[model samples]
Target: MARQVSLATQLAQSPSAWNGHIAPLILRAMTDVYITLAWIFQDREKRTDEYVKYGLGQRKLWLEHFKRSLVERGEKEPEKNLFVKALTRQLNAERFEHITEVNVGAWSERSTRKMAEEAGCLDLYRLAYTPFSTAVHSMWTHIAGYNLRRCRNPLHQFHRVPEDSDLEPDIDYVYRAAKYVAKTFALFDRETGVSVETPSSLDQFVESLAHPTGEAQTDSPDPLDDL
Candidate 1:
């Protein structure tokens, strides 16, 4: 959680990273990470083991792809063999290539939706995660509505085409990202009864929005700002 939030904070520093085109991807990933972390804490030993194995399996799967690429195109691209061998050696530090089992399915053998349901965060999955998935997957529902605009030419049939969207920067994504980090902190405290001296990044972000003179801003803040 600390690492995730630290990376998020660094990304948040870049205003361009907050755009609708990119922010949803990070927010969606954060939601998955949070929900998965919460679920893992419920059964740390077993789930963590499963998670580690799944990651290794994925690495092996990637190594196999590289190996196949080398075999198929070794003559044309000889450097790939050296890179693949180097990667295989690095991966073998933990478990041998022969011993590491490959699992092509979900690590937990349960879908993230099911895990989110068990973790009592199905609402987050439904509202934020699933909607953001449309953008990540480039679903017709999102691209057609967001990226494509109808042509104004009356002579030709109204046809939709992609446009370079010029959308105003929305602070809402920052708030959502901060909220996820805060939730992670809260989850950590809840699970381990550990308390830190400093305030969460979310609180700091909201507090930073105040006028420098220590007076509150006059405008009505978004309700989520209270988070």
Candidate 2:
């Protein structure tokens, strides 16, 4: 969760990540991480081991895919593959190669939506999970709107031509990222009943941005800033 929040903060430093397209994608990823941690912490005793198992299974699946890819590329004797053997040893160091089972399936053996529902964050799944896949999968609903623009020529019948237009940087992305981090910390605090006496760096950053001066401000932020 901390790593994911750090990634979101790093993304906020990028102007390109301030736009509607890129920012939402990163926000969605953070949202996913939030959901995953929320679910895992619910049953740490059992879920942590499950998480490790699934993670190792994924690594094994990847290693298998790498070997298959090499074989498909007309590489004979991929068994003695140098990189594969090294990776196998590394993974074996964690657990024996024969011990971990590969699962060509979801991490929890359940849909993300289901997990989110159980994790009490169905809203995150609704808002962040499926909708953001458009930009990733290049769906018409997303690209047809964001990645296309009208032609200037009157002779072209105002047809939409594909163009990657530069969008104005929005501060809302930073806030959203902060909110996700806040939500994660809130969850941790609620479960553990222990939090630092001082506020988190994100809390300070947001409060400072929301109230630049030392005094507290009650006014609403700019409407567009919330977008």
Candidate 3:
């Protein structure tokens, strides 16, 4: 008879068996959260700019000066406020020059890397896991009409839901992307002597070198989508 693998044993083997799959998944999840937050902040900034430009109209000069002064003050002591810190660190001065030019996707990619650099691998791991967890929880909540926070394996919660449903596709895509990120990072860890296990395939190692996209599109959503 074959020996049954315990959860502990399965998890113990994961660093070697599933590192490749998990790395991308982590990256994908972080990307999603970063992109969503970027959109929210960018939208807010756009509305504020519009108000200053149009609402204030002929008084635009005064409004612009006030805005510039506010930004300068925020830059001088950004650490005093969390929002200012984020804006200064994530949204560079050049990018903030024109609200319309803000690309959440691009910003998220750059910000994530900056986070990884300033913090450490573990910090990046947390950033990736937190949003992925929230996304999975949200998916289960929508399908079961109840929270699935207590579930041992949130991924299983997805299986109980419909395949063609609105949230399912997103959940699946995020999960896959997270897996890819985890694998990539794990490989990096091993290469840098921070991890014990090494990746078996170079495919993930190669993929990590390429830039991440907004999201995986099964079909071409638009011709300019890639751009």
Candidate closest to the true structure, highest TM-score: 1
Please give the CA lDDT of all the candidate structures.
0.83, 0.82, 0.41
- Range of the 10 consecutive residues with the lowest summed lDDT in candidate 2: 214-223
- Per-prediction TM-score to the true structure, in the order listed: 0.86, 0.84, 0.20
Better of 2 and 3 by TM-score: 2
Model 3 agreement with the true structure over 1-227: per-residue lDDT tens digits: 00111222233345542332233344444444433333334345764464334422323333345556767866554245565444444434435423433232433344444434433444434665454454455554343542223445677663443332222222333334444445444544544567546553334433544424665565557577669
Pairs in steric clash, model 1: none
- A best-first ranking of the candidates according to their lDDT comes to 1, 2, 3
After the best TM-score superposition of candidate 3, give how far the Cα of residue 151 lies from its true spot, in angstroms.
31
Give candidate 3's error at residue 2 in angstroms. Answer: 17
Greater-lDDT candidate between 2 and 3:
2
lDDT of 2 by residue, 89-180 (tens): 98989974788888778877778888899889898788777787677677898888789988999998999998888888988778778878
